[model samples]
Target: MKVEWKGVMPAVTTKFNEDDTLDLIMFAKNIRAQIDAGVHGIVLGGSLGEASTLLAEEKNVLIRETVQLSEGKIPVVMTIAEQATKVAIAAASDAHENGADALMILPPMRYKSTDIETVQYFKDIASSTDLPIMIYNNPVDYKIEVTVDMFEELLELDNITAVKESTRDIINIGRLRNRFGERLSILTGVDPLALESLFMGADGWVAGLVCAFPEETVAIYELAKAGRPKEATEIYRWFLPLLELDISPQLVQNIKLAEVATGIGTETVRKPRLNLSGDERKRVLKVIEEGLKTRPILPDYKSF
Candidate 1:
């Protein structure tokens, strides 16, 4: 299963039971929707998936289950966000052993590593496993940006195939293309900026809001690629309010609530992160309700 490194690869929410246990039932349901909607791949244990709270064993469970659920129809990519290089390497190995088709790796968590160190960390992990990697270059959230110059150093590793471009800099996409050409694939990580990124030549979207709005997300991607910018913009405009939810700090809870409204998930979050309440919940619900109320009838994107 070679990772194409393009198309909608969702950083799906990790479903949890009331007791905070993994809820495979709900998890599988959402994944089924993604596959049915024609997504290219599924990313597990990412920020939206609450990677920090997930145990290594639990991450392995997610990888194995996604591998089974996708049934070879799509790639299963596990996220590696460990703080220690050794631990990150181990996690990458575990993901490979657990049937993950690829990995989305973050820079050294908590500690801001220097350029030399960051490049080496990524190289070390890529060397440790044969699995292809999509570097998550989100300096906005992670405080460590994989700059274009740094990527020049990383390009030596064939397994370093793609990047989850979340820098929020629209120009960075062009810069990457200018530098690497097609040697490295670029996927937008920001929900709000997805279409813009795609039209600017991004290869795919590592989406967040797609966790709940799989069909709409895939429709936007397909429409954009099909040269139907008008149709894609129409859906993207309607999806803007809901997509904004993915940019917040409470994205996990926000998307889970969207999942509940969309009838594919529950709002059961782990401790230290409670469900949205009071005006906050009301505000978020208002956005979801409005989006649903005005949900457009999508064109036959695949026909394009």
Candidate 2:
């Protein structure tokens, strides 16, 4: 299947019951809600989904349920960020078989000596599947960062077609985009820089914030695509504070809270990846409350 990678692809949250099990029902509801709100794409098992916290089977189940819920209307993109190429390859195949439209692979995190294991890991998985792969290059959580040169080399693989650049450096993204041009679909993973990236010529956004605020994120992409920079800028400004929260240590928790606050999804998450508690959550919740008070022109998201 030729998956068109563009527009809003929320790094969706994996809903968990209070007992720490995957909440497939709430998760499917969230996916259906985003699709109804008009997001162009959906990334099932990314960082925001708490990939590290989920078991392999749990992630597999999440992909399967997401594919079932999407029901072929939007593309289902899942992450395979394991350090071992074999694991990554296996997950990619699972995603493909389970109905994912594309796979997003990131550089390995453990044993960061920058060995051939690093580059060849990507090569091994890229060659393992016919599914179109988009490399996710985020430097913060993962120790190894794929450089433009390294990524360009990986592009020699036929299946490697797109990338989700989740760094703050617009200059780096611009440089990569200028060099690769049409050969790569550059999607910014950070919501704060998403608008800037669109203007800088990125093809899409793989965002976590969009899970709760789909209307605003989609609007940002549309207005920018329609050449309405002023309107997009205003929208971006209104959500900038909330966008900052998406990158914090509390991102996964905060997104679910925002979703619950908006009555779209649950705030429940797994124990190892617990939701905010006590004082910290109180302070963070205050930001959401205050942001809600300041009216920003956005879509009226209906309860699903």
Q: Give the number of the best model, judged by TM-score.
A: 1
C-alpha RMSD of each candidate structure in angstroms: 0.7, 2.7
Q: Give the TM-score of candidate 1.
A: 0.99
Winning model by lDDT = 1
Model 1 agreement with the true structure over 1-304: per-residue lDDT tens digits: 9889999999999999998899999999999999999999999988645889988999999899999999999999999998899999999989999999999999999999999999999999999988999999999998999999999989899899899999999999999999999999999999999999999999999999998999999999999998899999999999999999999999999999999999999999987889999999999999999988999998887676
Residue-level lDDT of model 2, residues 226-266, one tens digit each, is 77889889989988888888888778888888888777788
Q: Which 10 residues in a row give candidate 1 its minimum summed lDDT?
A: 46-55
For all candidates, the clash counts are 0, 0
In order of appearance, the predictions have TM-scores of 0.99, 0.93
What is each predicted model's overall lDDT from 0 to 1? Answer: 0.93, 0.81
Off by over 4 Å in 2: 113-115, 299-304
